[model samples]
Target: MARVAVVTGASSGIGAATAARLAKDGYHVVLAARRVDRLDALAERIGGRAARVDVTDPSSVREFAQGIESCDVLVNSAGGALGADPVATGEPSDWAAMFSVNVLGTLHVVQSLLPQLAAGGGGTVVNITSTAAFVNYEGGAGYSAAKHAQHALTETLRLELCGKPVRVIEIAPGMVRTDEFSLNRFRGDAERAAAVYADVDRPLSAEDVAECVALAVGLPQHVNVDQLVVRPLAQAAQHKVFRGPLFER
Candidate 1:
């Protein structure tokens, strides 16, 4: 029997890639996201199950978890950035949306599925965070604040899961080339979305993040990678930039 793995935010980017990757790694991947069509397409390609789940709603998350008999791996990639303006000028509603999905929504999934995990040997959890956790982004206060909460959750969960079979890991990637990211950041401004990746010499792809996740989950059951920070080569540091002559140097 194939071990089951649950992936949130599975409609696009890292979550989508990780779901497919896990399926290739022999786990029956259960993908949950708001975009049912996209999930259905991906699940079809991977021969998995795609279910509509709104993480922001506790009951929705519960129904998704309830359907799972037993789960071995959980990839929490359901977060995204919202609003990129100084807090003084940023939309408070966007900030609230970020928190609702990134922090509270994560807790909803964790709480609903934890008992299943505990009963099934305490499965591993990989929460997708951001490099923004350790640094600040101007006009990105809301996204950062929500991710900070996730960072805390990762660390706290790790400690709490100690000695148990479960492991909680965090993958903080910088500048991943996922349209879902830029679209969310710019609130569906496609022009702004295109500009974000255009300036960079190279940006991390969704598959790159998924590769790291696959590697982490591939490890021996006794081994645990607490946190993995991945960034594009051009992104030396949070605010630091390396120049390339071809594009917008």
Candidate 2:
């Protein structure tokens, strides 16, 4: 039997791309996401299976894990930025939502699947964090805080699972121009989303992030990549985005 790989947030963007790449790599990919319709479509295309999973819900994650008899890899990509309000003006609810999905949700999925990963003989766990994990920007308080928490979790898991058969990894991407990430962060404001990547000649795409995930996970089991930070040449830092006609390079 082929190895089993579970990918959260597999309906679109990085998750979908990673699932497709892993499928091509010969693993029987299992695409899990909240959008059943999209998941089914993607699963059909990749010759994988789809599961309707809401990573934020512990019961849902537990059930999903139980359904899979064997799992060699897990890609925790089921997270998003909720709002861009500054710390002082940020909605507490938005902050809570981000934490629930980005931090706590990752923990829940790891807890549920760690045993399967171990059983499969030194598997890998790839946590999809972001540049916000280690940086701060105005109007990015909520998302940054949540990603920071996730970074902490990823590090702690690596240390705690030291002797175990699991290798914990983190992939942090900067200036990724996905269809939903900025749009959802701006509360569906199309103009605001478009302006986020307006002047950048090239921004990281979902496939770019997926390539990172595939590289990290496809490494020999003895090789563990602790973390990787990916950004477009146009992005030097979280706040250093060059814009406008004169700034374009």
Candidate 3:
């Protein structure tokens, strides 16, 4: 039997890419997400298993964890910026949704699997947060705040789980180029999504983030990567970017 890995948000983007990579790394990847069709297709392509999981629901996560015999790695890559714009114009629903996924969802998965992780003796927990966790943005208030809370949780977990063999690491990616990322940001506004990357020569890709995750996961059980922050070359800072003229034709 292969080492088991539970990956959330595995239908697309970083989650999907990481799931495939981990399977190649000799683990039987179990993917969980809200999108069933996408999950089925991805599972077929990668020869892995899929579960319809809503990370926000404790019952769903509990059952999902129980289904796995022994989970070796838990990747919390199931969050995004939903309606995370200026506070004045943001709706309460959007704020609630962001907190539910970014904060509660992460907690739900961890809480459900803490016993499993502990029972297995040593495992890895990689929380996929964003640069917003350490930085600031005028329109990224809510998103940043939630990531900040996650960052705190990561640190606390690390401290509490010390000497227990569990490695709690946090990867903070910057400007990852993904369809879901832009779509989630713009709520499927293709024009706006295109505009966000119109000028950038290149941005972070899912593979790039997945590579980082693989590196962190492959480390010896004694080695622990506390935190990592990565961004594209063009993205020197979150607010600053390199762009070309829209009509430079």
Candidate 4:
């Protein structure tokens, strides 16, 4: 039987890309997300299954878990940034929303699927974090804090799962240019979202980050990658980015 890999946030962006890549790698992928239409489309293309799951809601996660008979790999990718306002002026709602999805959402899914992950005797948990998880930057306090919490969660899970049949991996990417990430962060402001990647020479794409997930999961079960931080060459750090053409167009 093929290994079953469950990818949350599989409706679009990194999640969607990872699902497709994992399918190509011969895993029976389960595409989970709140967007049923998008999930269905991707699921059909990849010959996988589509599941409606709101990772932010514990009840939804529990319900989703009930349907899966076995899960060899679980990719917690159902997360995003809401806004980029400064801390002092940032809306509390936005902060709460970020935490709910980035931190708690991951927690809910992991907790619910842990049994199935461990049952297979060689399971893997891949958390899709971001550079914001490790560093602080202006206009990114809320998202950063949430990611930091998630990073901590992934670390602790690795420790707690020691000797268990599961491997916890963290794949953090920087400057990934995804379709809805920036646009959602700016609340549908297309101009602001487009400007985020303007002039940057090939910011990381969804497939770039997805490849990281596939790599970590494809490794030997006994070999665990504690954390993998990926960033485009143009972005040296959270606050440093080269906004010029560095490659041939």
Q: TM-score each candidate.
A: 0.95, 0.96, 0.94, 0.98
What's the lDDT for all of these models?
0.89, 0.92, 0.87, 0.95
Please give the range of 10 consecutive residues that has the lowest summed lDDT in model 4: 79-88
**Is 2 or 4 the stronger prediction by lDDT?**
4
Model 1 ranges with Cα > 4 A deviation: 245-249
Model 1: per-residue lDDT, tens digit, 1-249?
889899999999999999999999999999999999999999999989999999999999998888988989988999888768998898888988999999888899989988777777558888999998878878778888899999998899889878788888899998888867889788789998887777678788999999999999889877899899999888888787665643553
What's each prediction's clash count?
1, 1, 1, 0
Instruction: State the lDDT of candidate 3 residue by residue for 11-36, as single tens digits.
Output: 99999999988988988888999998
Comparing 1 and 3 on lDDT, the stronger one:
1
RMSD of each: 2.2, 1.8, 2.6, 0.8
Of 1 and 3, the candidate ahead on TM-score is 1
Error of 4 at 42 (Å): 0.7
Could you give candidate 2's per-residue lDDT for residues 1-249 as a string of tens digits? 899999999999899999999998999999999999999999999999999998899999999999988899999998999878778788999999999999989999999999899986678999999999999988998899999999999999999999988999999999999989989988999999999999887799999999899899889999999999999888889889876443435
The lDDT, on a scale of 0 to 1, for candidate 2 is 0.92
Clashing pairs in 4: none
**Candidate 1: TM-score?**
0.95
The alpha-carbon deviation from the true structure for residue 77 of candidate 2, after best TM-score superposition, in angstroms, is 0.2
Model 3: lDDT to the true structure: 0.87
